[model samples]
Target: MATRAEPIRQLRLRTPTDLEAEAVRNVAGALNALLADTFALYLKTKNFHWHVSGPHFRDYHLMLDEQATQIFAMTDELAERVRKIGAPTLRSIGQIAGMQRVLDNNADYVDPDDMLAELRDDNKDFVQRMREARDLCDDSRDAATASLLETFIDQSERRVWFLYETSRRGDGTGH
Candidate 1:
């Protein structure tokens, strides 16, 4: 029997003009940042899903799963898009921790409200970065990337709204 060598796949990026390429890089950087944000958010949501209790246990349990699911898909999508653009995707834990603007504590348990607050802040940070990405893409004449950023911003804002609403409703209602 003959041993076969490993197969190699090389991805190529379209050679956009300088300005367009800059837009792609800017968007890619922001998206890369967004991936890190999502990873942090994913852990937060998963933590809350496991440790959240009292008052809104059922609601929050399902909510974390739903919200985290969106980020999970986005994580893969963003990384692939980065690779498609000939840029490397940084998915390592240290890389993610270093790049992410979001703050999360994976070392210890936190309260339900604290979990919600942390995730809300992270989503809001994502919205801000995504808006920046959209503006950069638009200025650089890359509507496709702009559109992608818009979609992500939309969902992130909705997530922020959801968590905010939950926090608001939890106050003084004794649920």
Candidate 2:
């Protein structure tokens, strides 16, 4: 019943019949984490965009807007990669919760400092997930996806450092 017409049909992509099962599963697992992390982090970025208020409000607001755009783009790229591997792309919040290794913040009111803390943690989680993805990709001899994961992990590390630095400032303890 499989056909090439379906938008999500991935068998057409032609993966090796003898592909490393464990490595593929690990890569898929890591991508699922990335999927959920990106979605949840997208929500957090939107929250901070709406709620952030401090002397650095304008700066953070602009930065968050740009970061959110990048995150959303990453989400799409990751989902497509899942489809390319003949796996189902994550489609629901429940699935996201099942796969994500990171915890969401429960603060009723997020001060700017807390917002930065939240984003830093989120980015760190994403970076770790990407690192795992790269490892799996390497084991599977998937240089293309490994290269993509390299970009994602690099961006995540940079974002984490930027947010952490913002949170740890002294004179500009603006968070």
Candidate 3:
């Protein structure tokens, strides 16, 4: 009897684009990293949304839920951008975890103030990363990707601002 052939495990689709191969590769890599970090942040935000408890429980919970929803919204667009640029996108959660730079919070309990502070820092860092990715798109002459990054960077900046305000003490300095 003839041996059965194994199915192809890694399939690379060729999406046509005018951009150079190296440019596509670099932008896709950056976008994928951003995508991974987005996923990580979304999960962390939802975790806090679910576990948060304090005098401001309702406000904190609602804010986290909104932020998580916004973060999750980016995933599909990011992945599609990668494909549009003639490159492959993230395949699985393992791929996301491997590429993610945003730190995960697996703690059983985190103080409400601490949670806000942590998310603030994370959002700030994410904005910086998105700026870097935007710069990469600029260098590669990828206007579409750069434009998308601009919107995401703005959204992340707003998240950072909200997080900072929410976590601030009565003192205006927030020191």
TM-score of each: 0.80, 0.81, 0.91
What is the Cα-based TM-score of model 3? Answer: 0.91
Q: Which candidate is the best by TM-score?
A: 3
**Which ten-residue region of model 3 has the weakest summed lDDT?**
2-11
Local accuracy of candidate 1 as per-residue lDDT tens digits, 1-175:
5334322222233433444556667767877887888787787778778888887789999999999888787888778766655566785899999997767776566778887888888788778877877787777776766777778888889999999888765446766
RMSD of each: 5.4, 4.2, 3.7
Report the C-alpha lDDT of model 3 over 1-175, residue by residue, as the tens digit: 4334322322347588999999999999999999999999999999999999989999999999999999999999999999998888999999988999999999999999999999999999999999999999999999999999999999999999999988878865645
Stretches > 4 Å off in candidate 3: 1-12, 171-175
List ranges where model 2 is wrong by over 4 Å. Answer: 1-18, 172-175
Order of models, best lDDT first:
3, 2, 1
Candidate 2 C-alpha lDDT tens digits along 74-153: 99899887666655678799998887666766667788888888788878877877887788888888777799899988
lDDT of 1 at 128: 86
Rate residue 69 of model 2 by lDDT. 85
In model 1, what are the clashing residue pairs, if there are any?
Answer: 55-175
- Worst ten in a row by lDDT for model 2: 9-18
